[model samples]
Target chain A: MKADTNLSEGSGIPAEARKILTQIETDRAAYKRKLVISFIILAIAMIMVLIALKLDFRFMKNQLPFIFAGMGYTLLVSFMAISLACFLAVVGALGRLSKNPVFNSIASSYVSLIRGTPLLVQVYMWYLALPQIGKALEGYGFTGIQAFFTLPALTAGILALGVCYGAYMTETVRAGIQSIDPGQTEAANALGMTRSQTMKRIIFPQALRVIIPPVSNEFIAMIKDSSLVSLMGVWELSYRAIKMGRRHFQSLEMLITVALIYWMMCILLQYFQEKLETHMARGDRSIR
Target chain B: MMENDSPMVKITNIHKVFPQDVHVLCGIDLEVKKGETVAILGASGSGKSTLLRCINFLEEPTAGTVEVDGITIEAGENDKLRNGRIRDIRKRTGMCFQAFNLFPHMTVLENIIEGPVTVLRQKKEAATAYAEQLLQWIGLSEKSDEHPSRLSGGQQQRVAIARSLAMKPKVMLFDEPTSALDPELVGEVVEVMERLAKEGMTIVAVTHELHFARDVADRILIMDNGNWVEQGPPEKIFNNPEQERTRQFLAHIL
Candidate 1:
């Protein structure tokens, strides 16, 4: 018994250490099983890809580079449109939160009208109707109205997408602003801050934490919805793919390639979104 | 109650009726002289907190006149002042919350200096220097760089008091500053308040701690159903009961 005790102590592996080692082993085994499952799923995905490649992919092979080149336009339009949307969303959120009836009604109408109509219809309206108004203005001897009304197809598409997305994002921003505890506002007021000062100094900083995740989600969705801009004859990813496929009568191959590219872009965006979430949650981690 | 000096804070016939005719504060009249620490004690929903909140216009009294350091604001039925006057009144009063509502995104030092630097338009370095002193006074100098979320309940409340002090308001309002604290954490906050009282700070506190009221408060006001049931020196309020309601409340809480 003494030898056994001495050996165990000398080896530095006590009962508690053995228990921890067993727990670690179980955890590692569970992780290994998950890895195996992921590999199986990846293999299935690879097999599907092989089957798709075996199909009539000659047109896709020739056109993939050109369609991929259009990724730049797709990204550029999405970036500009999303930037514009964020600005409009902030302004709309303020209007929604404002007590003034004029601002309130204007914001309410904008959101109702935009959200009520489909994006496709709005794109057409911007692309088609504005130039008609420009021509009518020219007929009425308002020659300077040309710049105001006659927007290029790309410009119209961007504005329509921005305005429509802004309407949806307004509600998200409003909810985020309101979700902060009333106690925070009360505290700010009791500290002698005016309403705007309170909002700028205390409330908005906190609200941004809750607002960012959903806003990032909207951005991801915006990248995909940007395809609708292609309807206005903007040479983006989907437009290039469609044009190429129709010319070669192999629409399925070109469309599938575009879909894969979109999937890859979305995956990349999700990875960055997770990193941003971790960065934002740094201050909250200690307490949680 | 003094002859020559004006009241540090005075509220006359303040009334608050919420929507659906629920009267939260019904005709509260109060006066606290300079250097006086008054404790208003009552059970939850008894309107003690509401009365305290109304003094700072945190809840706009449906009817009342409030004077802080002789600057007065009056409100009647459908009569309200512009945001300017409200802001003016609030600047003269510093309030500490029960939840220690420090701006979580800011460090303790930043929370302390925000009001002074922004509303008061004090120089940032001067405000920061003063904040350092206040933090030191509250025994939180070491934690100035840390965020509120990382601090314990007691530490957060102390930093909150320091934040209020940084504004240099004429009077301090504490709304049950320790009611949310852990049992072990309550004493630290109470000790800080005790020190503030000894240093002659004008304070109106809505509190649940009977011992704090009995020991530190110059006067004790007991409320029930939005009315003050009793008000007197702490010894009289604690030892020589005048109203049955006061006695019952003491029995329940103490």
Candidate 2:
């Protein structure tokens, strides 16, 4: 309480409210500076869009849905790929930690080979090399397996992305499991929990917090990289955008719109990421 | 469960050494009778904590045998024993770490219930009830659903004590439970241990807290340089220390 007279000067209100209002007013200049900076960035982005459209604005609206149609395909592929990657990550991580040398070595080699090579090369190999693999299998008494060699474009793309991300995800899971204090396991052991019980009940829940943010980051990256699948004729958002841009001779407009859409999607992803992170962090009260 | 009054733990000529040519423990032997609380006091690197770990088979002994309730626990010729038998020994002993080691992602209730559900194969409702009772006993009733990170260090350690107790362990091994807590928080944990001792639990503890040993321990074994320098009732060990090392240890503490 500063003084009764100071409080009465504001009348019928708490002194704390008066103090808060005064502080907000005092920071008005700093708020104005931040507002100006944001406004300038928005203006620059709008001007760039206007200049791009002015150069080639013919039939832009007609191609909008055609280009935007690819968004569904993109989401469909990334969702399937991430689901498969999650499964592989769990299995591969467990295999890496397994006591059996045969399984461990197989897992180790898979991770190394997948991580060491470029993902594009793997995509090419899976699509082009699989026919040869199918042919060899047919030679081993499997007949008319040519159809097996022929993977649908979406399936090929999903397999490539899932396998590539799975390798990296295996390491993320391993690091997370290792991050837990050794004493937690020892305590679980002392309580007569079997190895599986300790892992499922005590270790995995804690490791999840460490694993999710990086896994989500990988998913976000995979969204952008899904464009590479268009090379195989999957007709995704990127491919459609390019084709329509060339047809209408408004490549700049069409491309800018696509870019803007991608940016907006990423912004949405970033928002969801922050929300998920906050939920995870809420469980660990140490921050408060 | 083993009888409450039986000799709950037996350690016979245990030795452990790492691959790096360092002899951590050499020819140690000890036994703990049920309903007795024994405190192992030692200087830094004196093998007290290692001995406690060996009883629970957490640290594999390099040689010799350990028995729990007259049953052989761990056996090997000159190396770490077979994993299956070592895990069997661990089942009979409940261990509490200095750092509490509560599962950070789990609530206090979940941490306490986990042991019963996994070890005893108890139903969820039964385990939850058992854990709730233990939580109440440990004075953490208000924080049953709270994660370990939110609890005070002393409260988390109490939750750990309750978690270990839920398994109905024949023996409890505490490795410096209070050493990891803030100085002001030490009394709360020591008081919990005192209550457990009063209830006649067979416990082996490694600690630097002279007051806990003085008040609660039936016998105190002082170690120096990986050997038991002295062992007797705390009265004789702390007040009338016989060996030079024990005398020096007492001098530093008292």
DockQ winner among the candidates?
1
Task: For candidate 1, give the DockQ.
Answer: 0.64
Residue B52, model 2: Cα distance from true site in angstroms: 0.5
Per-candidate DockQ values are 0.64, 0.53
Off by over 4 Å in 2: A1-36, A39-46, A286-288, B1-6, B77-85
**All candidates' TM-scores?**
0.92, 0.90
For candidate 2 chain B, the 10 contiguous residues with the lowest summed lDDT are B73-82
Please give, for residues A1-288, the per-residue lDDT of candidate 2 as tens digits: 354356568776786877876676668868999999999999899888797657554466777788888999899989998899989998899889889999999889989999999999988877878888889989998898967887888889999999999999999888888888888788888787778988998888888888989999988888887877887898888889888888867788778778777788888998899899999887655422
**Candidate 1 residue lDDT tens string, B72-116:** 888653435556677877888889999888888888999999999
Error of 1 at A182 (Å): 1.1
TM-score of chain A of 1: 0.85
Interface RMSD of each: 1.8, 2.8
List candidate 1 stretches off by more than 4 Å.
A1-28, A39-46, A49-53, A56-59, A135-143, A286-288, B1-4, B77-81
